[model samples]
Target: MNSEGDLVHGRWLDAVGRDGVQQAVGLLDALSEAHTIRRLELPVHTMLPVVLRQLLLPVMIDALGLPRTRQEWGERFHRGRFSEDERDRLAHYLGPRYGDRFRLFDPQRPFAQVAGLEALNGETKTAAQLVPSVASGNNVPLFSALSEADELLLMPGEAALWLLHVHCWDTASIKTGAVGDPQAKNGKTTGNPTGPLGQLGVVVPTGETLYETLLLNTPIWADGLEPQDRPQWAWDERPAGLGCMPAAQPVWSERSATGLLDLLTFQARRIRLIACETEQGTRVHRAIVSAGDRLAQTPETEPHTAWQHTAKPKKGQPHRRPRRHTSGRAAWQGLGTLLAMTLPVESDGPYTSLLLRQIADLQRGGVLSGRYRLGVETSGLEYGTQSAVVENAIGDDLPLPLRALLAQDDGLREVLLECVDQADQVARALDGLNNDLRRAAGGDPLPRDKGSRPSARFLHGLDATMRRLLAGLRTVDEDDEELLERAQLAWEQCVQMAADREAESLLAAAPPRAVVGRTVKSGDKEFVYRSGKAVGVFRTRLASILTRVAEERSAKGEEAAAA
Candidate 1:
């Protein structure tokens, strides 16, 4: 292991008690065992591997209107419109060893019944029955039943979804660790194939990373494969085939793509329960199979991709270079304006625009074309053009009531409200700084204790508070001079107070002599002590914010003063 990994492992070892350490080791062993079993299931020669191919084969077989019997499949393979190579491949796949693997086409294992939307009305099977179980105990039954060519498929409309969820999660887990780290060696940062943390029903609660992983796995239609190529009727014509709906495509259309994401997001919120028979009685417990379904539902749960915004890419799209947009901010601003017209009072507008803009920029940078590159800050002018527009518009100083009324009509009300709230929060945070430091020091300040000592809690709280305040200022409305002045003052005071506190804390925490490093223990948690760098890093952020705030104050102040 690398130094970083060793350090992290050591920390984990120390943090996880004796029992926890055993459990952690056992989990890793189980995961490794599962991976080994999965590898043996891979098919000999195909672009799509065994499990993925198997998952989609039943639907493909039914869609192609192939016969259930191996004899008929061989006859069709010889007679149908297939290339010589395709014919040979089909023949080999249908041969004794691999033939039974095609569950829908295997005549021996007949389905109990056909199920679809119509069947949903009368179907009584629980979600747990339809989807594969994540519980180790249930794996044996799931593998046995699902592996059978004739076993029941719950809902054809939903089967594609579950297949996608299962396949992508498996792929992601194999590449990354259990948590699905995007920065992991083989992990994909962009695209619809996120690591499988959700498939195992583990929520990391670390920003939107896990949710992004799920969206990354959404099965999109290949550019080479169009909807017209394989018409819906092709699948519908087959008799005894359960599902009538075509497989869900992420790039079908804007409406279709959005709808799929919405449905996936909804399913992500549903929890599935597995029933186990014990000696005492029947026991029902939660399983990871439904983990993706039970994702925490929220507006942010939906995944965003550049492909969703533009038409489906043509074949060879990933190999081509994308054209750049120098004045691309206008495109994003136009989208923002349209959204603002129908904006919700509580909804995030600018941030939404920001994400959209970021994706658009990524698209322009050939991100869709598979051109990997680093991104530098796009919005990096001493003062932004948007702020200038707001300043030019802020001509007259109106009454407080009139200002409030106008603010209601202003398209940027949501952004402005957030700014006001942040300023208020930071101001209040500054007022309570001493108490926070005291709390970190066990709720009692020593007589010789200086207010400058930085504790983990105090540093983290200040860091968070300052970031919020700065985010609000990013899109601060210069039109409202009164509000602008108050916000500027708050920004200045916030930076100054934070710097003073950090300096005092650093000096107070200093030992008699400087050493290479030291460790401090608080309760059971151990913290590595670095010499005053925390305070220094905190100051850098404050300095950056203050610089921007000062520029706005100077330019907008003179304009407002003249008005």
Candidate 2:
């Protein structure tokens, strides 16, 4: 970081003895970017965001100062750059000792680690604890083949990548509890909350380059930003335990972020890296993980997450919290929640992350081009019981046309949203079709979740088609009846094919008894439960669900005639 606290990305971490690509792996967020919506990927971890927000963004905002009016924030964003004055302020903060300060092996001051932190534990913890994915200690891997007894060997690069992962998504488990922490019970700590990103479906705005991505993610401060505490690495003196020499671990406390710096690198835990020389290379064989800072009352300020109103809020409790990512659920399935306009329309609504709002502001100001396509990437870890087990790691992306994204009340947004609703309806219809098929075969219908396999398959099969449909929005100027009709036809055909395929597969797998069919008599009425009977009923429902789009169009036409 420069003297003014701006994160100097280039050559900043070269002191770590890695090349650009190697450094990028350690620094950049886990999900990588490409030219277009070519592919989707998982995030390795989150590190750059912490450094940029803590050391750079706060100072940069203050240099730019507060906005004169409501319109100014968007205006500056439209311009999309730092001013000459802002650049000068950053230049003034540079110093010569940055090289030595960034050293990982610095005897007095190491980067993102306390020098003598190993003394607190008096014994080294397993190396596996640094990486969230590693199955060790109490991380009982129900889904993994490796047992907890198997040890892990980490290279310097691997160690660096997962080190950041632990800080951001560390699970709640037994901790050292440190000497000063009041929450420590019997010299051991439990009930420590997971890292800030633990429950959040992390949302990040992607651009062509790092500069563009960083600027796009930065939300202009309403009242000029003020520089508070610098990032821990840039501090004048290193204090291990919240400023006490003897106490080298933070007390178990939760409070609001003091400033951008405090919140970004919130330090969910205090860590010390034990690097040693080995034949292979510098290996991080052992380390210590202890409780650090905790995130409390922060749904509004955290820019990287979506927020939803709790369905059942207690009388005196807050109603909103960071939205969670569903395991095995596609991003396109919940497109409505990612949009900003959906919040005001419903009582228990989910508003989008703050970054999405910033993008909309830029579009409204007429600074952004409609030709540009936006890639909204979402990533998060799904923790199991007590937030200890890493059940699922979710990462997905949606490439939305700028014109469609900026429209809420009318235009392309309505067309896209309407199509999504129809797709969902079709999926549910498929689920019912499968249940009926089973019932006709003389077997009781399965549960909604189990019977919905076909529905899930049908929806997942359309993922590529949906992406193409969204990308195709560029062909239309705005809301066009013909365009929406054409899109609806495409969706209907996809749903029809998927349902028929699943139905045939089920029938082919049936036994001889089921093929013969069954009948039941209830009073005077006789009912048939057979493949033929189920097929007839399914066709009727499918036809009705598919034709609703046309029916709605016809009704709207009649309403226009009445007017």
Candidate 3:
């Protein structure tokens, strides 16, 4: 009836071609027999191919008639007239030798005779003969049948529709090239070299075109059919590690349309949405009825009309108003209380004392029990002071002891002086002990009674005694000038001897300069005081004293000269 119908019919023929015609007929016959014709109101454009392959062909061959072979149609039908110009163009483009390709299918011969069969007259044919008869030998007949059918069925108005269907169906098969070989000139032979059939002049069809056509013609059918599901495609040139965010879901509410719109606008800016549960047993209908009735019963008023219409306050009576101060004060008081509780307790001197106090408080308050004696033997002061000192120095307020030592205060100075003296004495004692042991280990130069080797306990006791002595000395006050001076002098002498011994030891050990450097601070300022600079100051003073003596000598000489 329309171009769409022609397109549908053409596609059906193309789908059936020759091989599928029998199957195509059977499906259509079954539908026809079922009397469900109304349901078959599919667009002819979309239905034709599917009906031909899936319903028409089989029933037609079994119930109606088998398709004719090309040779049976004779030379008149197969050999069509062409212009001289067309022949010349074909010869020029395909080459003169390509004429041989056209000789394969000779439509002049009778197909029934070629197959060694008589024309059908309601007689049954054996499958063996039938199969061999349609074998085609050097020339296939199916492609010619499809081409002929396509020409017969397609009208000028139907050309576009048929092309669209064919294009869509052809795309479904992903066919590779031209439908027919250019070298073939004879109308009798038909084969597509690059069509879906992978041979020249062969037709290929898929059901997609039929489906689309049916949908276009019969829109009502779409109501029952599930919409086709298609995955969205996107090109992401993002780096390998990237990913896309998921789409957000809608949140529904029973608020007024304006209120809902406002909420949606707010939610668009927020990262997450929260759902509030409605009251239990509050039916939506009941809520709507209540709201509508309430609105109807209420009188319309301007803004603040309720306040304006209220009874006037009694004269001379204190006008009662909502108190805003209580809540604000309560909030502020809470904040102050939090700050007070969180502020660190300020404690000076040893943290051990503060810790002990806290422990005692806890025990008395029943927060701690069971004969607990939580001793914190800290070597630093309490937290606040430490925090302040470290923050001032290095953004970390250290404890009092560490701050004192790091800053090299008077206390640290006294301790360091004490350590130096103690270290020197210990070194001297160790040297003496080593020498004695060495002498004993070797045959003594002075004769001595042989006995068991000296007990290691003696050396251990010596070390312990030295440490205790140093510890006591380290606690000594800086005001003990006499003791400090003596210790300092002795330390200097010991240091000189130790340096000499270290040099000799290095030579004896054959230690590298690198080892020596690692063992000592090489910078001049590091040990300038210990390097006899203080001694040099003394020498300079002595020289100054000598100069005074020389001046006195010269004065006496001048007096003698005057006499």
Candidate 4:
């Protein structure tokens, strides 16, 4: 009922019923004239408070045993067997709780001045009164009569007993070496003592006596308390009833402490299912409840059946609902999955989400658009970057076998050839433009028609041809240094050519064209030329021609170098 299905309400009801029964029994026993006994049935849980009292009461009574009263033990002091020193020491140690019945005597007397003084005093003085007065006056008779051994032997037991008594006093004084008696004045002392005796005055004997009592009674008391009929106090003489109490076990309260945790886990799964069902617009609470009951009944054996129960749609359902496609948004989900895969094991949600968003944007913008769609798009980019990194990791002067492997392995070769070919195409295109511009500026004739302009198709074809040649070189198995050198040079030239062509295009389009003539200025310096338009046209045409020538030169150079 308290979310854990425990019968807490039932427990409370039982406790109330038990208390009523106990009160009724008490009233009936009191009113009965004849000797009468009644047995009542009380459930252990309901009777627990009473049981605790029954358990502790005997222990308290047994603990207060045998001295019967503190006065009885004090009266024993007047027997005259103990010397005056012994009497004084005992009184000092035990304090006024025992009263002043005992007294110390002078050592010289050797015997009592009056034999058994109570007998001498006759009716006037009790044994308690006469002995303490006789014993109190001097140190000599006390020290003379008792040997050190006898004194020491008498001490340990009495010390232990006194400690137990002090332990029972809740308000026992703790102040050391104060003169006035503790029991005489509400267990408080006069003043704190500066001396060692003052320090001793504060020393409570409780713990030591408690230890002795526990040692003496533990085994016997433990056995006696084990029987259900025995009072719990039977174990009290064994260190304050500790031995009688049951050892603590794992409890329901401990299990309930983690109740919220278990509930949250169940709720999380339930919420997920609820979200899915609501999204699909299913209304079947009875079915959900029935499935849950079934799950609870055979949780370990029919897990899949329970799952199916939740998944099953209601009867007479429509064949299909209208589907809203969010493929674009779903694509972002794929990107998220990809980014999550690449992330370090320790990476948390925010970093992963941020990276996924960036990747998703890149994919949608066509920046990363290609055959490698979904998760693979991000993966491909990662692979390409990593491959380049691996290649560069191997230095320029790599071993011959490694170089051959790099040049011939289909994957490695493709990567390298693509890089090389791109460089070559760029260089040739730029170089051809720079050369044409120089020629036109030196008064060379320039074609005036659009036919003289570089063809887009031609430039594209040149790029395609270079790509294939580089791809072929990547397939080559032989490791010729000269071939490698030619490849490198070709790649460098291609990059330089591309730059020159771009520069030529910019120069031709710069302002003050007439004053500049057909000449392309390098910096502040300008060379003379014919027409700016003509030079632009001528340079573009030559660049296309030169690109083809550079490719052919690269091929021939590669073949010759290989040979």
At residue 329, candidate 2 shows an lDDT of 77
What are the lDDT scores of the predictions, listed in order? 0.29, 0.61, 0.23, 0.25
Sorted by TM-score (best first), the order is 2, 1, 4, 3
| Candidate 1 runs further than 4 Å off | 1-171, 174-459, 463-478, 514-563
- lDDT string for model 1 (1-563, tens) is 11111111111111122132322211112111221221111111111121222222322332333233334333432332333554344444343323333222112321111112111122223333333332122222423434322324232223323333343232211111112222223321112222122221111101112112111122322232223222221322323232223222111111121222222212211112233444533333222221121122222322221111223346744211211212212122122221222223343232222223332333333332212111111111111232211011000100111111122355333433443344334333432443333334334433433443233334444455444443444344436566656765675666456646655654475453322334557999975444344334444544454555556667888999999
What lDDT would candidate 1 get against the real structure?
0.29
Model 3: what TM-score? 0.14
User: Could you tally the backbone clashes for each prediction?
Assistant: 16, 5, 37, 27
The better candidate by lDDT, 1 or 2, is: 2
Residue 24 in model 3: lDDT: 21
Residue lDDT tens for model 2, 324-413:
778787787777777754454336778887878767667776756666667777777788787876777787777766666575676677
- Per-residue alpha-carbon lDDT of model 3 for 332-351, expressed as tens digits? 11111111111122421111
Give the TM-scores of the predictions, in the order they appear: 0.27, 0.80, 0.14, 0.17
Give the CA lDDT, 0 to 100, for residue 25 in model 2.
Answer: 21
Identify the candidate with maximal TM-score. 2
Which run of 10 residues does model 2 get worst, by summed lDDT?
A: 28-37
lDDT of 3 at 121: 27
- Alpha-carbon deviation at 246 in model 4, angstroms: 41
For model 2, how many clashes?
5
